[model samples]
Target: MSITSRITGSKHTFDSVREVLAKANEEKSGDQLAGIAADSEAERIAAKDALGSLSLETLRESPVVPYEDDEVTRVIQDGVDEAAYDRLKDWTVSELREFLVDEQTREPEIARIRPGLTSEMVAAVAKLMSNMDLIQAASKMQVTARCNNTIGAEGTLSFRLQPNDPSDDVENIRHSIREGLSYGVGDAVIGINPVEDNAERTKRLLDVTKEFIETWDVPTQNCVLSHLTTQMEAVRQGGSADLLFQSLAGTEAGNEGFGIDVDLLDEAYEFGKEHCTASGPNIMYFETGQGSELSSDAHAGVDQVTLEARCYGLAKRYDPFLVNTVVGFIGPEYLYDGRQVIRAGLEDVFMGKLTGIPMGIDACYTNHIQADQNDIENLAVLLTAAGSNYFITVPMGDDTMLNYQSNSYHDASALWDIFDMGPAPEFETWLESMELMEDGRLTAHAGDPTRFLEGDR
Candidate 1:
């Protein structure tokens, strides 16, 4: 190969290494060839190949980029009367929710629920937020809850009946919860889980959840149906979700917990046909522990098998456009062993394949590892490669607050940056080194336990 040395203020190409070496030698250069410039073609070619490989890895990690920037904006603008996002910029959760609900109510097909807040209401506001994107929040919105008490332990808060019945006094309760939650900081997904035994009771529970959800003057895109209904085969088969919506469009709750025995596949399909509205929100999510420890109840051990089954069932039941599921890790325990963490995640993928539901993850943890740039990027690459489309974690920067922290405000920008590399130097390093693992798993740099990855399946 030819190497060339560039003269001052000159661009030159070297075809022969020897010639460049001879010139350098004459210049009394040290034993090493100091001032020579090699053709960058080789490096360029290597980088190209490397980036191509990394792109494939990223794709494998997150397959669903459903709301592209333009698409999100277009849908929002077209569907919601094109309220200049600029005018509604920096609005809080409640403000944004209100904007979308108001816009959605204009559509004759969708109903609106500008329900006033009340103490008895358990609010479950469904939202799809993004950065620098047009969000079609003006679509259908629905919130569902099961007042039956089968979900929680016998003595737990959810197991006991709350002061108000969601069905009998939903409107006032919902108003109270909405007002109360908006006063606090944290995303509100409030819903009641009443203890109910049989299908009839379960149906009654769902009916209560539905009745409360339907009272607002505004339209609901879809109800955030709790996993309680997901447990009822009868409810799953009974057209509960469709029956709940003006548009019959919304999610069927179940991907989060395993207790619900409803054949997700059968129920989702039937629900889709009878009540699933074209514009309703549709996605389910399940849990994975950060510590790698499974709970004794329905959520034990981040059961990939159960997760996969649920995913497969959902996919079989609904078209890609109608149904989606997210599998997530919630505790620090799942992070205890990077390898195990990935294994649990892959099981989720296996479930997704079996059932055919698009998957995402909501990374929630009580104690997250504090990381430097390299550590953060490395973790991102590894986790993404292991089949995580969405990562909901603590934000980076000076903000001391964390998500799900007791009354702490989560920085929207930090959450946005979790998986987004932006233009960081270490991010490039992590991207380039994504495939390098000791046991086919990524690990944090020496002395950094916060970062990790997978080694083998």
Candidate 2:
């Protein structure tokens, strides 16, 4: 009936029993005895419940804590005076359209509210504007130029040469690079996520890539998509890389899981900036996306989109040369379908560009999703028309290594041709020298010269 008797099956007091156990064995045995006593107490409580001797208290929910507003929210709230915002909100849709067309009236207000505007509001406003007006608005939002100034300068295009082989064989990777460059890709950056992630392999890949860059004299950079720590290790071991790369999340724990903290990131950035051989705005490359916060269990009650924007703020602090939002790579639990994916992709680009970060879209989808290459094309075209910085073009627009399909090298060429756009300045000059471009048009050297139809080819 007593606690000590219930646990130890002996007629000893609890304190005496604990002291005896501790003396006989060690402090650990005493702790075990304490656990037995606690279990016995729990059983007694359950016995009382069986006898209907327990009283119940009414349950009350805790107060909900409000999210701490971010700088973008605070800035927008401050810039749009309450009275003006209310009046503007009440204006007829047509009146809003006309106001948006007038640069003097629209730019100031739009810039203020743009950070906080919902996707629906953006879509509604976009529906009323002409193509030219949309392009102009996107241009006004540009803060940082990226990818050798071609992206923000002249709607430049580029792709990722993901030699995702497990061995990371030098010959295979070299062939892929040759093929991509032969078609005028890599203007943005020829980045690879090496299958075997280690300092030696990454260094080998970078060395081979540098050799190709030098051999071909292409005006582009090479990146091995490894963790920032691994990249730093490679650099320290005398491995050459043009850019340091990592996938970053919004929260500290999430970043720490990837072996990076803000201080580590700053160190990597400084090292790349000092050692970079490529011609670009900056030397650090970062990849981020929505759902990563939730996936990493670091969302902290903030919406995914807002958390993603905060990541951009973190990335901006380092002045990265490239910040790509791999919009749908995490799949449908966060985005659900193609419609959500498209909207999120647009919203990410808009937010990233507005925040003064060099932005690119890894307009991609997993096989398990309802999206496909067509969905990517739709987002890519819309973003391109809205002055997106760059895109990741894989072989045939399908990533054999990552097992997903994205925009292809041909897709980049098509967007250029349809919009009459060209590559970045330095890249364009290189392409002209290689005869990939002539008279502002992508020559046969830029794509399939036979121009075969889909089935015919």
Candidate 3:
């Protein structure tokens, strides 16, 4: 079908956009975007008068060697690559600064994609996109989430710690607190998902949130806590979406079990705004396979509906800069649908495109496993295309042999190095470009001993 016809077809309720366009035409139109200007080249030599006379002052000591040569210094100074050195030699300081500081030089930009196919799911995607954009716009800070629960006989786990102290594991709690505040993130979402009932879980979550705020003004570093897995009061928790809506729209509080209450969330937002000095810590729901694999259809159902709406609403409310998602808890089973994940990921990208939001993929798993390079690369490409520039997971090194399950937490730095999209320069090569004096001192001149593009300059 033709584009115009498709837009007006059964998928869309619009009978005609011609009238809308006509009305828009009748109204005033603002200034159009300016066209790119063409440049003219003129290599005209300046008259000697225009150039003015110039005198060069030689340094008191133009030592062949800029500094004292020591073994350590020599080692530090000998790592520059030929190509990089050549580039440096050709560049002036201001030019080099401009090159390094320019935004265009640092990161890959995914072009903006317009929102299409408005639906609950699309809206959610749009919101996530919006939220992600907001996050990227903010200063980068370390953010972490932690949870703990005491499983009850009803299959519903009572969230033990308040939002503030979910982890009884002192080490985990300390880690979460330190991680969040150390970088001044100051904001985080704490939630619980029940394995059984929603209402009970939510009650517990609220109780914990309240207790957390009252307990420690600041938490210890490296503490362990129970993370939330489910919230029963939500509509999709064995009931209709309507029930969830009613709950969100309902009373302020009664008692909770797991998950979040809309009223409580609002209260927390206010609390954070007033007391925490931070603006907002969002609410994110974590779900795992209820002993069932993630079918393409189920994936569609959530990505298309619940997740979409929830994120969109949050974006509209908080207008977060970037939207980050943990693609179902890290598990081997879901990896089966890697292809499906790719598809769903694409949908997320398109949705973000429409909303001008950037998204980040969070590979949340307890196992300290390194993901496959091909999978990581593909996901990175897909995410970048979808307007994401950040990832939330452990750093990784390029060890093709190191699978996610086999690695240990001690390798986090390596993992971080591998998984991160940021530019990483090798240490040894950085030392070679220095314009070294016989005495071995540092200098900024590209060929000087001090000029290391990649490292210990």
Candidate 4:
């Protein structure tokens, strides 16, 4: 059905919920590139106005991608709690927006209705929300998960030690991990993106990192961010890894481009449960971003925000331990600049939390984006305030392998200090034992990698 809005005597008509969603989204270069963005500011606001007035029932009825054709649509539609959906089916998106931001409506109330809302409904509200609105609403919610240790507990901010080397040098990665651990990093998994996707390389990387964790009895897990298939093959060959890592997309076609689908993900989840080294449940690690569908020609004429929310829906199926958006890594073509990158970082984290997934942000930008370290640092501080579960930290804010700038290992401590936060509880105890941190602050012995070296210490 068509939705139209008249604002200040100018009329704008959107062809479908898909059209309205794309137009209502905050300025994104990806949408513009797809020729789906609103042509003018008034048009954008009009679309938002139209969208806010859409009932949750309408959104539920109108799957952005049809159920018959898309596994993702089926996952979202089939997962809703019918009773909760019935209770809130008639509410307008704007009312849901108010409920999310209202001081009286805490996470419990929100959580109760969370199962009723679809990804489109979530994206619709986000389009109507201001930047602060996103942060304030998200801060009220805390979603925690466990693999090796708990993540997303209150008053804690964790970091993933992304000790990636340009080459798949096991020793080089080991050095970076030592340095990061010295700074009280790696509270989250020590995840490495390997230089190659071969099973042999993945196995070797996992072996080196897992050995270090065992030797030091570190309180975190180890993950080699290879394709799930490669990681599984390595583990089948007797390699050690605490988590299974994979990139996810919103649509089945988009996922297909990455050589994955719901079936493969389900198989991987079951495999991790049976064979992954982490204790108990929650062993999957997923990475997503806004513009992946469009970049891969699988967007189906939908907006990036809507596509992004669907990714969370898919992720929720696995109850993943860690899910982060490589928010600005997609380049200027999708996020465009610092402003867009910051907005997307906030939106992704907020949406993930609302979905009840332990969410975090790789608040980063590529070298070519109109953003710098300062912009990413600004995003990191905002994400911490927004109660993010964890963040991806590279040595010195530069990922030599990925060719991007993210938060530095040093940045995590700075954030904890600024916000009176500490690392994950178990990790904090480890840090104190290692003399890397004391009283929620880095100690004198912190930042000294030599302390971890064999006999040289």
lDDT of 1 by residue, 303-371 (tens): 222223323332333333222122223433323333333333333432232222333333222335222
Model 4 accuracy (lDDT, Cα): 0.92
Top model number, lDDT: 4
Candidate 3 global CA lDDT score? 0.26
C-alpha lDDT of residue 235 in model 3: 16
TM-scores of the candidates in the order shown: 0.31, 0.70, 0.34, 0.99
Clashes of 3: 89
Write one digit per residue (lDDT tens) for candidate 3, span 1-97.
Answer: 1112112122211122211111111001110111111111110111111111111001001111122522111211232233433433333222322
Model 1 spans with C-alpha error above 4 angstroms: 1-213, 217-264, 275-317, 320-334, 337-360, 366-457
Clashes of each: 67, 2, 89, 0
Would you give me the overall lDDT of model 2? 0.61
Ranking by lDDT: 4, 2, 1, 3
TM-score of 4: 0.99
lDDT of each: 0.27, 0.61, 0.26, 0.92
In angstroms, what RMSD does candidate 3 have relative to the true structure? 24.6
What is the Cα-based lDDT of residue 68 in candidate 3?
52
> Candidate 4 — which pairs collide?
none
Ranking by TM-score: 4, 2, 3, 1
Is candidate 1 or 4 superior in TM-score? Answer: 4
